[model samples]
Target: MTTRDTTVAVFRPDDERLRDAVELVESLGATPVADPMLEVRETGASPRTDADYTVLTSKTGAEIARETGWEPGETTVCAIGSATAGALREQGYDVDLVPDEFSSTGMVELLAERVDGARVEVARSDHGSQVLLDGLEAAGAYVHETVLYELVRPEGAGGSAELAASGDLDAACFTSSLTVANFLAAAEERGIRADAVAGLADAVVGVIGEPTRETAESEGIAVDVVPENADFDELACAVVERAAPTYHD
Candidate 1:
């Protein structure tokens, strides 16, 4: 009898996130393949002083705000998810709101109800969605944005193209839209975009959230699973369940 070794490609941006994905993959008995497609770096921008409310869409945004020595003061801080709210709390800022749904659209809906005639500051990466800002503006709130971080593809990331096109991977996990976009960009750069896309079509494509799943679909890749919660452990479980039949065969 031969034992099957399942490989799961992890495309998280930074080391901290990659570590979590790797651990989850190992826990599910799958070999973890690091295919980091994006790198997060601070943009050295501070929180806006002219805003009455602040919005954070990711934990990285919260960390960037804290590192820049921005004081929340009386400004109502809104987060998109529990993890982002917890990060703000760790920095001693009282998070005033967190939407039940952890997406920009969800944040917009939450703020639309309470942010009329207010000035809002959106702190996030350079690639952050404009939906929250536009929605707030439509809801009668003046909005400003601070790009606290930037997402860039790491140098020499095309090496993963071979692995991605090899058809040996059992699953691929994407944590963000940028990761999905960058992965395809790297594959295209290596002249293996078609193979990579075909290989992924044959494998289970797991995304951390609906936004990423939508991005994958837009790029012509069919997604197989998306966890209820946008967490690495949940993504791991989803991938493990999808790959179980292959492992046992």
Candidate 2:
């Protein structure tokens, strides 16, 4: 198999994210199928005010906080992963804590041991998880959650479903659990869920972390690769590694 024979599906919503995935796929000499599964729309909700600490779970959350002019003055900032931390730092917020595992459970463990009787604000998407709120509450922290954006499946996601059913995808890259879920949902809507799952099972499925891998597996799609460091570049490399025999031989 050659570069022309290797086709990868990049399922991230935002243009910047899609571009990054495309570039990574190109760098690996593979063709990228850009079909955004979800789109991010601002919710127009203001960030919580006067909190002792602020939590950001994704890059979208950090971007929303920056665009909304939310200041973290003297407040401890916590991020779920390095990407989120980098996004927060770009917005002039110093990330005080980043969990080693880069997941809600990881953040919970870190905060449960350190944060007590503190007011914490969580900024995330409308479909964000309740794990942080529940975990923080159980750890004795008052958590104020605000939805900064909404992750909705785009109307033209059927292309992805078709691609998945075509069985032409050599690898599929998923950055978040929502991406995996939305892709499966799109396939389900098109009555191609079984074919989509089979196609993904036949290809190299690269996930950013364990959570995304779990989500993909839960949808009956076999995940072949998960990067050690939850990053897109690493995920892309993992895909290339998994597909190497097809292209290299």
Predicted structure with the largest lDDT when compared to the true one: 2
Q: Global CA lDDT of candidate 2, please?
A: 0.84
Q: Any runs in candidate 2 off by more than 4 Å, and if so which?
A: 245-249
Provide TM-scores for the models: 0.93, 0.94
Candidate 1, residue 120: lDDT: 95
lDDT by residue (1-249, candidate 1, tens digit) is: 111377788877657878987887776667888878988888899989668889988888888888899988778889988889888888778898988888888899888978889999998889988788889999999899989988899987755556768887777888888888888899898889999998888888899788899899999899999988877678877887786654534
- Kindly list the per-residue Cα lDDT of model 2 for residues 16-66, writing each as its tens digit: 988888888887778888889889999888677788878889988898898
lDDT of every predicted structure (CA atoms) = 0.83, 0.84
Model 1 segments more than 4 A misplaced: 1-4, 245-249
How does residue 58 of candidate 2 score in lDDT? 90
Superposed on all Cα atoms, model 2 deviates from the true structure by an RMSD in Å of 1.7
